[model samples]
Target: MAGLFANDSEQIDRRTSRSICDAVGERLQQSLRPEPRLPTHLEQLLDELKQRDRDSH
Candidate 1:
């Protein structure tokens, strides 16, 4: 009976630690995530380049 409780305690501790690590990893990912789109000035430059390409064609 004592051995069973010890095993259960270890499992619970492992699960708790894993959960905490997972939460911290998720928050770090959110904070470190890059923007998905270019800035406005870069977008305008790209658009102008695309127009020039189309005109050349």
Candidate 2:
């Protein structure tokens, strides 16, 4: 039945948003010229994650 296989709207929206974020992140990683240190990259990733958390609320 259509009901059994239908995707929830909210679920679809979340998946789309996640996929976009991942694609953008990948593009950024590929475009960066200087290879940053491990700690620097980790800190930036943490900051981006924190910003996303704040934006969601």
Q: Pick the candidate with the highest lDDT.
A: 1
Clashing pairs in 2: none
Q: Per-residue lDDT of 1-57 in model 2, one digit per residue for the tens?
A: 777547675345768889999999999988986876579788999999999999999
1-57 per-residue lDDT for model 1 (tens digits): 677767654566778889999999999999999979999999999999999999999
Error of 1 at 35 (Å): 2.0
Candidate lDDT scores, in order, read: 0.89, 0.84
lDDT of 2 at 43: 90
Candidate 2: deviation at residue 9, Å? 9.8
Give RMSD to native, each candidate: 6.2, 16.9
Alpha-carbon TM-score of each model against the true structure = 0.48, 0.37
